[model samples]
Target: MKKLLLAMGLSTFSMAASAAMVDFNTADADGNGAVTMEEAAAALPEVSPDAVAAADSNGDGVLTVAEYEALASQ
Candidate 1:
């Protein structure tokens, strides 16, 4: 149980670190206020098209920093 807890904690920490490393400003690429699908895709290759679509909750075809951060955290 202790080992499992430790592993989980480590996983959470790593996810947080990765999310922090890629802030919205840096990922925006074009210096726009929002991150486009292309920018999000480029920043997170592991994320699927569906995931990107889901992250864009506003349906504006772009991810705000908060949205991108949330997606990265996942």
Candidate 2:
């Protein structure tokens, strides 16, 4: 019973962490389905442009939802 309680607690914590993710639409100011460096800055001032560049997995100078989620998850 104690082990089951511990597992439930861990799952709840994981869900809470995932729920705290940054909003992709708010970051994508242009509504273009991707976030440019400028938009990312506006949404996450602490995040550097270099970080955004690194998150641009497709070399498109922008971050897709998947890319942004990957960065935020880190």
Candidate 3:
């Protein structure tokens, strides 16, 4: 049973990894390939302000494409 569960978990992980990802190049506005606070908020309007701030690692009040991509990849 343990082995079966492990295999199922691995299969689920593989399926998740193979899923299509939203291209950051297209998501980033202003043609800078980075997501500013306004851009991030625009892209994910449903996200709370606190969540947006949390994603801003540098505390620059913005999230870059790379940063958003990293978050999505996880």
Which model scores highest in lDDT?
1
In candidate 2, which residue pairs clash?
none
RMSD to native for every prediction? 10.2, 11.2, 12.1
Measured by TM-score, the strongest candidate is: 1
Q: Per-residue lDDT tens digits of candidate 1, residues 1-74?
A: 85465446545655766533555765676787999999777666667989989999889899998888888788
What digit string (tens of lDDT, one per residue) describes model 2 on residues 1-74?
85465446545655665432557875676689988888776666557778878989899888888998887776
lDDT winner, 1 or 2 = 1
Please rank every candidate by lDDT, starting with the best: 1, 2, 3
TM, every model: 0.69, 0.67, 0.55
Model 3, global lDDT: 0.59
Model 2 ranges with Cα > 4 A deviation: 1-20
lDDT values for all models: 0.75, 0.72, 0.59
Worst 10 residues of 2 by lDDT: 13-22
- Residue lDDT tens for model 3, 5-69: 54465456546653224346534655686777676555454556577678778877667766777
Write out the backbone clash pairs for model 3: none
